[model samples]
Target: RIYVFYGPHGCGKSTFLNNLLTRFEDYANTEEGLRYEVVWRLNIKKLKGTNKSAMSLSAFEKLIQVIDPENEGKHDLEGKDLAFDDKEQEYIEVPCLCHDNPFLVIPKDQRRNVLDELIKNDEFKWKLFTEKQYEWVFKEEVCTICSSIYQSLLERLGSPSEVFSMLYARPYYFNRRIGNGISVFNPGDKPLRRNFILNQMLQSRINALFQDSNVINYLYSSFAKVHNGIYALMDVKSHNVERMVELHNIISEGVHKVENLEERVDCLFFALMNPEDKRNLREFPSFEDRIQYIDIPYVLDVNTEVKIYMDIFGRHIEGSFLPMVLENFARAIICTRLGKKSGAMEEWIKDPKKYQNFCDDDLILLKMEIFSGVVPKWLEDSDVKALDKKMLKKIITESEIYGKEGLSGRDSIKIFDQFYSKYAKEDRLISMPDLCTFFKKLGDQPKKIIPQGFLSSLLRMYDYSILQQVKESLYYYNEEQIGKDIKNYISAVTNEFNSVIRCIFTKEEIYVTEAFLESIENRLLAENADPTRRKEMREEVLKKYTTLTLTQEIMIEGKDISETRLFQSLYDRYVHNLKKRVLEPFVANENFRNAIKDFDTEKFKTHDRRIKRDVTFLMENLSRKFGYTQQGANEVCIYVIDNDLANKFKNA
Candidate 1:
């Protein structure tokens, strides 16, 4: 198979191929060995060729060399690892490129029947005959030289058994260092010149056996070295593009013709190419189907992108930034790679503005989260339910066309280097502000590649998220009291005003008046709710309590009123409103701001005891609940207060 990995430069195409080779080597070394014997890495520019004629071999002269009838051990090193220097001239050996398989020593006509009779495993025999790749074992003849030798030896000896005595098998060694099993060709390497090889002693023995004196030798070329192995071209451009064209016959017909002989090459062919270099193949349209193109686009997965950074830099780099701020930076870089619009995202989310607090208008942020293997909790229930397998598949499939533009892998590393060096400090951890400022100040040339307005949307999402975190960290309401309030409110809403009753769940006495109703209703309903809206909200709670809670959960099921679905809903609203207003008092207080800034320092203790306690609790909880350093917790609090986030989202 001829595979062409096409992508932008610095997109890790070579890294992927190296990893693949490592995996292949591991698999081949396991107990169950691989089917292929060797892998040859080739540089097309260094492959030498010629049109000159070579001397042919006579019957007996080639037979003795092929069969090695003397058992002289001249070719014993064919399978062994060899180490040689240029000074050691005697040890230097030319590779036998057209070496024949030991089993091919048998006459081609009778080989299959002999194998069938010798084999005992019926299933194994069936597989060898039926599998397409293994068909070569029975269907294909040996190299032309070996085939000619076998016939001549059979006729001269006049006995098949005598000719079979010379057949033997040797192990094949795969050494990457010496280019035995694996070889890599670079563009600057000079082409190999043609050479003819022969053994004098073996030729002398063959002449005595057949009494025919005809000197014989065979041609050797670079193509013969890579037969039945992996042949990879690093980059298919420059002189290599012409090499790819020369492979048309071998790739299509599975044969390489050198001089008058045909060498059958069954190798896994691979090439790495840039997207722009794909134009080099325009003159050869026939290569379109012959090559299998796999796109190695930019890293789209956020976790994967971060892993690359961690691999290049150190893993401790995570401690330099706030919890998700580092990932947010990754998201910002990925934003440049994505297209401005996605029809699949639009089909899933009809109104992108509804999630303005969490996602951008184009919903590229939302798509990125999905690509990172997260189904965001902020999505509306309707949209969440709509994300079935079919819709999710469509969304994921749409990502294949993205990551073609924007920042390359190298560009992201360079930008991260500049950003980290500029902002990472011993006094403070990297926060959202630092990230936003760094990208916002990028040169106009780089900024033009980024989708417009994505940075602003990202900042808004980060601000809203941190604001909520601060509210939840500061919120300290009694769980038991909130539960009792919900139960008492549901009981009062179902009954008439000014009525006195003992709360069934809380066991407390309550006066059901307008003031009592409005107290709990104020948290459940919006603060600006008018008379009709307040009435409708109270009635809705009452109807739910009577129909579902009282009938299904409380009475018939013998469940407590506090455990009803009605109680949980009212309880969530009650707690949410409490957390919403939890930051109101401190947002305007100068003392509170000072205490937060002074936190983790000696000056924090000099403030009022109440202020000091609140600041300590906020900082500690921010670190414990979210992954914030003490410095980060303090900085985020200052960020929230300085930006007036409390009033910004107070109505929300």
Candidate 2:
């Protein structure tokens, strides 16, 4: 069968093909991916003689005669480690060809009976070797050369057991370039020939006992080289129509017509072509029918796109000189490729209103995150509850249609290469500005391939990300104080809960309150359900909480029941607002900003504890939180306050 991989240019079809071949080759050589082929010990001299030089002489070898129950052990002779015994024979080993299995050497009429018998054996009884694979192997005929030699050996030896004594089996490895089993053909290659690949020993056997035989040596064609393996056409359309017809026959009929010989080529066929090439091939209905086209489109997932760069450039480019906006650059290029959501997708999504309000950019980004295995942060309980496999499938199908439109990673890489070179030559560090400049030119070009609002959106995101980073640094710097405040709030809530509770079982005062206990239960169970069920659930919760309180005294780390997700979610929201609260007073009040700039320590002392804490917190933690030195952080804080950089992209 011909498997054609189709995609737009720069979608990594070629790279994928090459990598697949490499990985397959590596796996085939391993023990788990083990395959079998037969080898024989031949005697050009006499069978009974102990000729020491026979092993050294390559001319004495004749690879023929397949055997049942062949050994599948690794070849020890592959290494130089030699252990010689007096009883060992010095015979030459020769591997058989025509990609024929050991079972094929049996007479065609006896094959089914023989296969049935072999399958009964413990080694062949396993599910690893399927009946279809056995049938495939059983159907293969040894090459004409091997057949001729086999007949001669049978006539001379007069018994099948004698023939079996000369043969052994080991792992078979496929070589892509040499076309031992796998052949990859590119454009402008010479046509396959029927030239016989005569063995050095067999070349002199023309007038021997097998003189009347039509098969002295096997014919070596490009088609024959990949017999029982794989034949890959790099770009099918690049070749002439005649060459494609040859491939069509192999794909459809599983046979290639050699000179006067319709040889059955048992091989898998693969082809890689762009969308235009695929369209061109569609004109020929017969050829199109035989192909199983697979799409190799550009990746939409942001994380996957980032990973491609990470793998290419390695963990850190130029020893930690990797630009912070490297991911931003990847996202910008991917954004250009995203297509609008399809109408077909609406059928999959039950409530279109849930997603109807989202802008094109927002939808695209959400799809990207979804493709990267991220759930949307804004999803409500109802929206999440409505999701199923069918909905996801439709969403994926919609994304697949859009995948054909995107600007390829290759296009982005070229732009990156140009700017990277500019910075490298000038001995300057790469930055987000360099990437922004590249995208600006791409978006502004006369024949713009990039989307209209791409550059502006990216620049806005970059500015916002920078500001967000600064705020995060501020949050981390004051984390100790924030933790203390959160602890105080928790303590106050606990005190109020303890005061309201009454023990149900002991008829004594209980520490746990009903409302507080219900909150924990609600996280795991339903809300506002049966009273009896709720009471029973509360008992279970009380037991776990009592254990936690006794063991760790309500310390968050020591508690067994999970509360981190809830606590963290609450903490993040609180701190997010706290950051804004801290910023608003400084941003709005010019007098407060001036004090911050002038380092008015005397005036700072006169303020309330909260204001004083905020003032001292910024002064102390800028360097430690962010990646800046003390002087740099101090300067950056003042710059941000003076320019009001936090709200710079607010209008966008």
Candidate 3:
């Protein structure tokens, strides 16, 4: 498309034009006229502009004689074979010397002022008019940039590395010019890799080359050494000049073997000629199509997730000794940006309680990121409401199950599966983009979170997608085995009697209230005569309530028993269930058991180092078992697949 950037001077039209120049290094590197902003890359070695000396045909004719004094209009300059060292006789050197406003070479500061007076259009600065400087493009500034790095590319004579070595090893602007010595130019051997700064300044930019390409633009100020001189033709509309077109085309094509420093002169031909050919050039077959056009999600800009992952993981690794990350959470542990949810601690240091024989609800909440399961009493306090919307939203947004409702069945099922995946696996990053981390935005506020596990049940009952994963893990075991494993999982928690008692029965409100009671208790016992004279405390142990509610959870789902019966059963079997799931197995499994038992098994026994073999085994097994697969299984990044399959996409 034509981008006409015309306006009063200094309004950024030129600045925008410079930006446009940097758009397609990858495209420009191709021998096939890599068109992006350009219709086709062209080599115009004998290119000349119409200027002062070019104002009249005979003036251009005489100037050409200077290049080849022997040639008069009668001699044929067509189909000529001119070597790099050919006498300056083969072509004409037309000087654009117009003394009325002679072109003067001025230093950087004086360039604008000097040109303003001498190079203005005749009507504007009539006192002196040689030739208006055709748009003067400055060369790219010097950089540490190396030339293309594909060394294995069979280049003639000088190498890609050699080209880079010469260019970057010096401090000079870089541009195209007549190359000399030994080298083959054009897209000789390798492709270009983009340069970028570590800072996340760019949200993203499109590559006009190829859509599937992931190229990004990195602003750089470095340039290689350059050379500049103006070429002119007295008149383009003359027969003699028109007849020399073949000579120009020949010169443009003959020097394909030249170093990068020399090859650029070939590139300059089209640039200088762009004004004349811009329209016709764009009409080519290749110019109209795009191999790539970038689309950037705004999420890349916030980068809140990546930062959190780094910080949290750093702290988690530094302080944590006994790590018990679930296998699924292992890969999905990305989305390093934490606090995307809001109000959560920037350093959410809920230390690991593995190998300790008991799991703190807070630790579980930390590992599982299941906000509803367990959290610091302070996290859910009404005071949390005082936090800003982003913070408050982050707090309740942990698990879809415990967050607000009203999601479409598909969405509800999707979120639940993602949470379970991240919760099940450890070290694995959450397969989330920055956009996905949020509770529903209600008006400008986040909705209140219902109790944990509410959404999970609702989705399973409402959306059959709950079957998506269950049928996989339990696919091998019979109902009896599945039931046994389930019971085993539950019973493990009660292996620590006090742990079970403290967990299921401790209401968050009660724990917060106890912090107050515990403080008071210390005060009562502190005074000098407190032992004997303090108000008599109840002469009893801290007994716990026997009855519990399994009603809203089990009974609502109509799982085999009445509300009263289920709670009674939950209370009765709670001892064994907690022992099985939460404590015993955790204390027995090699990965996590040692953390709880406080034993160090030797390295070999604790290792999970079988990479390729296991990955292949897992992929084959999962594919055969689940009927989902992608091309290039081994080569593809599993993070992409995990994120896609989990459907954890949020605002992204």
Q: Highest lDDT: which candidate?
A: 1
How large is the C-alpha RMSD of every model relative to the true structure?
A: 9.2, 11.5, 26.7
lDDT of 3: 0.27
Q: What would the per-residue lDDT of candidate 1 be over residues 1-652, giving only the tens digit for each residue?
A: 5898889888888888877766765664466753332111111111112211111244554445546656445444477643222121111122234444556556568777888888876898888768897766766656554555456656655676755554444445444455544555544554455433345544543343334554223344455555655667778876677667877888999888766667676667778999878889898888898999999999998999999888888998999988788989999889988888999999999999888888899998998899988999888779999999999999989899888888989999999999988998988889887898899898886778878888888988998999999998888889988887888887788778888998876789999998898888788775667889888988899899889998899889988777778888788888888888899889989999999988878988899999988888888889889978888888899999999998887777
For model 3, residues 1-652, the per-residue Cα lDDT tens digits are: 1122222222223333343443332233455523111011111121212222222223333445546755544344576642222222212211111100111212235445665765656564543333345323121211111111111111322443332221111111212233211111221223224321221211111111111123222222111111121122211223322322422432444222122222221222111111233343343435323212121111111122223333434433311111111221221222121222322533243332221212222333232333323333324334334445665456545432221122222332344344443433343332222112322322232123222332232222211222222123122224343233323322223233223222222212112232333333342233233533322431211111112223344445544322344324333333322222222222223443222122222532444444323333444544465433322122122332322322331111
| Candidate 3 wrong stretches, greater than 4 Å | 1-24, 27-387, 390-581, 585-652
**lDDT per residue as tens, model 2, 1-652:** 5788888888888889989888888887789986777666665454535454423312233222111123213223465553322233345455666555655666677766765775675765554245675555545676554565567668878987677676676667888767878888786776645333445554433323233435444344567667767778777665533466677767777665555455567777788887667566666787766778899878787767777776776755432222335666667767767765445434434454454323234455456666787776556556666557777777776776766865776865676566555654333344555666766665444226555665555555445545565666555336655444333333333344557444332233444566655553343344545668766654543454455543454464654222434335445645665554446556776655655554544665655566556655765665455454444444456656766766763322
Question: What would the TM-scores of all predictions be?
Answer: 0.74, 0.67, 0.19
* Descending-TM-score candidate ranking: 1, 2, 3
Q: Show pairs that collide, candidate 2.
A: 337-406
